[model samples]
Target: MTRVISILFWLSLAAVLAFITLPLLVVVAASFSPTATVTFQPFEWTFRWYGDLLSNRWLDPFLTSLKIATVVAATSGVLGLLAAYCIVYERLPGSDVLMSYLLSPLSVPQIVKGVAIVLFLSMIGFQGFLGTPALIAAHVVLALPFVTRMVATSLANFDANLDRAAQILGAGKLQRIRHVLLPMIKPGVLSGVTFAFIISFNNIPLSVFLVRPGDSTLPITVINYLEYSLDPVMAAVNVASMAFILVVIFLFEKIGGFSAQIHGGSK
Candidate 1:
């Protein structure tokens, strides 16, 4: 009876997951709809929306988002990794307090952060937003906390003996890291990069605040398209965006073995 119940529970969960992902499936299904009203049936199909996405307006923002997200992920990943290393391995003065402060942004509302950034920039007569760089800054800020926490968690189980062993073996600091330390915490570094990149890419709040005209990211482009009309094209765009996201995650997993990082298990 217990085994039967467990199987039933798992089946129910699988059904629930399928239900939740139905919208994405529907969006993909509708992207090829022939009519203006997108439906999931034996309907007319066409790839016109995919063709429309080729225009510079859509193409530009997609490129901008990619560039910004890449830079932000790199910046936040390195900074967060460094901070995690210091907090976990180094006995720096006031390290605990500093870690708390660095991670404090996670507690603050995104709206508050955006407003604060906007205000600060405005006060300084710095109006460089609505471009790739501003989005990079926003993505960096948004992703920093997640990267720091992920790296820190990996660090928690780290062995101090590894560092001692490296030093005793006459390995220098860079060599110790390259040869001994990095391989052990490789999962954390990979996790930090994935978490940072995904969170930054999906974030809309900070992007909305900082984005300037002609410099909109993909989400902003979606909103702008929605404001002008309600068409099945929206569904197609949604599906394309989803595909883009899945591609990024798939590549991350392919390159770094995403499961180990996320599940805290051995490779």
Candidate 2:
């Protein structure tokens, strides 16, 4: 019975993995397909669709999305670090309430936020700033809650004894935080930054409401293209974008030791 249960567990896990990965695999395959339609036949593979992605229609939005995601990641990291420090390390008055308020965005629907932001901007006579500026600000709002939560979790799990030891050794507040707290919680910060990038880059509903006429994001552009046509170029765009995201994640892992943190060995 034990062996049977173990076999079933493995089979169930395999099925879940397949369910998650099958669509991505199909998209990857479609990117290389010689014809517009996706197929599994080995002979139908070609790289022409990738070459077609060099045009301005795709490159413009790709650059815009990259810029937005990068800015969002950096901004979220800074704000999240500060918020986590105040809430978890300092334990300010009503810290729990403040933390809950910061994360309240997570509970609100993003579409509602986007629409409300648009209306608010219109009311304040800031309609001219509705494109990239609005999108970046809105994306930051969307990402801030996750960033705060992740950083707060890391701070909560940190060893306060280490900070006290640093203080006893004559380390100033800034010195201890710089040498101890930041290093220990880096994994969480990096994870939050990566999440910010992914959220900002892939956001559609919010971007749809916030984006200007000429400056749509890559995801929005791809969706709009789909309205006109369906082709392997869309698949190529998706596969290429996914590869870029993978590269970003790989770089973050190298710098942050996310795997080490997972194994409870991060320094």
- Per TM-score, the best of the predicted structures is 2
Error of 2 at 108 (Å): 0.9
Clashes of each: 1, 0
Count residue pairs with overlapping backbones in model 1: 1
Q: Estimate the lDDT of model 2.
A: 0.90
lDDT of 2 by residue, 139-199 (tens): 9999999999999988988999999999999999999999999899989888899989999
List ranges where model 1 is wrong by over 4 Å: 1-15, 262-267
Looking at candidate 1, the ten consecutive residues that score lowest on lDDT are 258-267
List the lowest-lDDT window of 10 residues for candidate 2. Answer: 36-45
Which RMSD values do the candidates have, in order?
Answer: 3.0, 2.3
Model 2: runs farther than 4 Å from truth?
1-17, 40-43, 265-267
lDDT of each: 0.80, 0.90
